[model samples]
Target: MLDQSLLSQSRAGLSEIEAEYIASSLLRVCPPVSPQHTNLEVTKLLNEHPELISIAVVEDNKPMGLITRNVFMEGMAKPYHHDLFDRKSCIAFMDKEPLVVDQNMSIQTLSFKVLGSGRKTLNDGFIITDENGDYLGLGNGEDLVRVVSFLQAEKNRLVTESINYASVIQKSFLRSSRESMAAVLQDYFMHWEPRDKVGGDYYFCKKFDDGFFLALIDCTGHGVPGAFMTLIMASFLDHILLEDNRHDPAGALAIMNKKVKTALGQINDSAAEGFDADRFSTKQNGQSDDGMDTAFCWVNTQNSTLTYAGAKTALFYIGDASSDVQLLDPDRKGVGYVDTPMDYQWTNQQLALSKGMCIYLTTDGLIDQIGGLKKIAFGKKRFSGLLQEHYLKPMPEQESIIMQTYYDYQGKQKRRDDVCLMGFRF
Candidate 1:
């Protein structure tokens, strides 16, 4: 959180301006004045210190006054630099008092003051000296302005960095899909085109001695909060599969539904309006934690058996020999809409497995994309057709065809929502 915008990208951590500020660059108290020299000699002195910042006059270790070249020339009787130099000694031209400055004074207060005050005593700066008052340094107005700007910019950068670190932690806390998978058919891929990078779309897998568990879920919102729901679902599903070895898909859903209702406080009448809360207050008003709409199935490849359960989603199966498929429509009762008629029962469907049948699941994003095939979505009709058209291709090629079709259809239309599709073939 420390401000570090002033951090030098170069090897030189200190800048020339900063160094000058540190040097207390100014004429004061006992500035190296030229009262001891004549005006002619002043020219030589100027030539010697061509890089001179300011000139002054000193007497007995104290500042008498100061005069710059401009003032000296304006008061000169002759036009030539040498004439003015020869006409008077530096002491004869000492400007006046209040020309000196102290080291501790801010450079910010000095430079603009000088410019605006036209070299008057009221605008004069303080002289800075060492502990011994030995004329240690001088201050300037411009440097302070620059330093303040640098500090402000540095502060902003630090704030941004702090926010980024916090975001990384929050995102990390939201779980991602498990990649270490085993058993059954490993021929699955994700075509996850999220409306945002982290969206409500989710999929998970679990392997059991008798069958393999698979699911596709989509939450309510997109981005960070959707990802949070995804994480919650992942944790719960993992707990059910690994810890309890609960192979019944409907049983898992019933338990998960209850848990989510409790977690979101949706069981009470007061929280019934949680789903319709304003955008900003959704998190506070207990927005739908039932973000996941899932189609789950446990496959017993050895026994050629399948048990599937779904909620407010759809799944399809394509016969292996050709392009014929079955679409499994969910029981319209979503994960969370209302606990009203709390007796709503979730059903699990059983199917006999065939060697050539391919399994497919998708969120509405794909079918509902709204712009494909002449500005029209490849809706249910076309989706089923694609199954009939590409059913013979390997799962990977089949996926590519869908992507190709998406691009071909979405040439100019804006993408509407998150799209996800998964396929498994026996």
Candidate 2:
């Protein structure tokens, strides 16, 4: 007789099964026969249930082997086969070494096991057992394949929706302070793109009593992790600007460095004592070495001056008096790492702002992108030439030209990192 209690229990748990254990839903309540049953009796039972594909042979509720419909019918159709084995035990035709799986196994793990086990399991099906190795029911390979494909498609749809929502949130945050930038700048243009739906590269602008403060930051990693770091950096930067260092670009950077280190727990003295610069890693030190490279500027329009500071980043500007683009190198050290000293000081480089002066700030993403006929990095030299060639153009036009050049050189190659470039004219 069929185990009606087990069938009812499997049906009850259908709604509660998690995505990981979806394979358990494939259980079919096929009645089992004992090994002592005659072949003629087993054939009578199979003929009565035309829909049955296979049945389990059990002794004391534990599965002993499997008897598939095709194998049984093929043997019975042979000449004198039924007459010879009519009174023989069902064990004569049963596959003693059939694949048996626990009902609670995850779908992914079951798929791997099925693939590794031979192709016969697919044709003959398999037996499902409980945690105690007792017979539960049977499972169909065809049903398993269909369920796996459906689950995979559903997972991809959900993930894509989530990432699309995240991209919207990140964009909203980046634009929150954009009015401040528009109020002070004579002209400006910004280009930001992530290799994925969301990225780590971000820019910030805030209007101060003097002029404005602007920053272009490249945080550690890319995609979701990088996006998370941008939010953290933005929060800390806002707090520092509002409460502590409003007018000093270098002072702001120094404070931000400490804040990042403290937030990530990268300020341990014990970890720093034996630090080997060449072999240092987050795994070895038991701390996240995540940090950001930033180019920060405080433009004092009233004084016609700009104070610029950087952490492993640089600034480029073409003064009205000369056609050449000049570079302002940053401090050699990066911010917010296990190796960076807590009290490290970064100095500011001040330059006079003149009419028609054009300034540019960028993350390493653009320069480090690999492409072109030779498949080399875009490099600093090519970037400088591109800036010098188009510095005289209008800000919007300059942005278009720069982006076009980048894409043209990037032909057939994949983007390596997030890219952000900002240009402004005084």
Write candidate 1's Cα lDDT for 281-332 as tens digits.
2244544334467887877767887888898777788765556678777777
Question: CA shift at 353, candidate 1, in angstroms?
Answer: 1.5
The lDDT for every candidate, in the order shown, is 0.57, 0.76
| Top candidate, metric TM-score | 2
lDDT of 2: 0.76
Candidate 1, lDDT over the whole model: 0.57
Candidate 2 weakest ten by summed lDDT: 272-281
Q: TM-score of predicted model 2?
A: 0.60
TM-score of 1: 0.55
Model 2 alpha-carbon drift over 4 Å, by segment: 1-161, 269-284
